[model samples]
Target: MEWFKVVAFVVCVLPTAHCASDAIVWCYHLPSCNDKTWPTISPQYCNGSRQSPINIVSASATPNNNLTKFTFVKYDDTSAMTSIENTGDTVKVTFKSGVKISGGDLSEQYDSLQFHLHWGNGSSVPGSEHTVDGKRYPMELHIVNSKSSYNGNTSLAVKDSTGLAALGFFIEVREAAHEMI
Candidate 1:
């Protein structure tokens, strides 16, 4: 009789544990960027004194052979607005249809769907990479792309890593900028 009760309890509780949704929990010791506070210290911002400064020189410059050099003029434009949403610990930005990035040694024009930032949740230390004087950058921005021949089927490419091409840019947070939460 006791064994039957124990088996019943286990069966009842097991499904509940597995049914819970998986979510990324961000531990914020400071206020987040979306918080409506006045100049509060955020874990995403690094103060000037406690941060690592990046120094660049002209001698170590190398031209990018894989990237397309096109002027992106729709940083704040609404027409270029794509789908921006939070995915786990990172925020994803997807561009509108027919927004193409070209001008490199490639035969096909790559479409810009979205750009996302992968960062650590602390000041003076971001979860990214940057390069200075031929060194790797502390933070890197990945501009994910797919072949334009697919006709705006980037979602299908994301499912397959081989079908996707990504361009990375290293950046550092100098001051308190608008955080894309």
Candidate 2:
């Protein structure tokens, strides 16, 4: 009887161990979003003094007159999407050099690379990476761009401090679906 119990434990634990551990390592879902474990899995996720999803306080924000207003060039042009996919965490759309942005405080111009959306499970749960006064929105959109100097090499650009730029905006919940949908 004892031998049978030992065999049962091994059968149940050994085969399923890999599945349970892999889920946490790959997804890093809500259960493992803690500070303690996340840094262990991906150091980059927690590295650097500045972290994503920062809490922005509008009242305390300061405006710099040195920064000029930005200009969007050819942003309205119709272009075909190169790719769209669900990355388990978010849905992303890729474009082929359709738009560019210049001016503002940017030292160099940038071109649109891709856009992605982050969403929570339900209305009650906040999903936006950046919060306003510690508030979270149900959904957020991020348009990623890389500096024009990189010549469309996002991989190389991402390594530089000025290489990558991400514009994020919140999507408020509506009583009914919007006409744009």
Provide TM-scores for the models: 0.47, 0.71
Where does model 2 exceed 4 Å of error? 1-29, 34-37, 123-125, 175-181
Question: What is candidate 1's local distance difference test score?
Answer: 0.46
Best by lDDT: 2
Candidate 1 to native Cα RMSD, angstroms: 20.4
Give Cα-based local distance difference scores for all models. Answer: 0.46, 0.59
Q: Candidate 1 — which residues are off by over 4 angstroms?
A: 1-68, 71-76, 122-126, 129-138, 155-163, 175-181
Give the worst 10-residue stretch by lDDT in candidate 2: 4-13
Per-residue lDDT tens digits for candidate 2, residues 63-178, read 76766766766667666467999977689988777577766666778887788886676654447666677776667787777788889985676466667666676776644333
How far off is residue 94 in model 1, in Å? 1.4
* Least well predicted 10-residue stretch by lDDT in candidate 1: 4-13
Clashing pairs in 2: 53-129
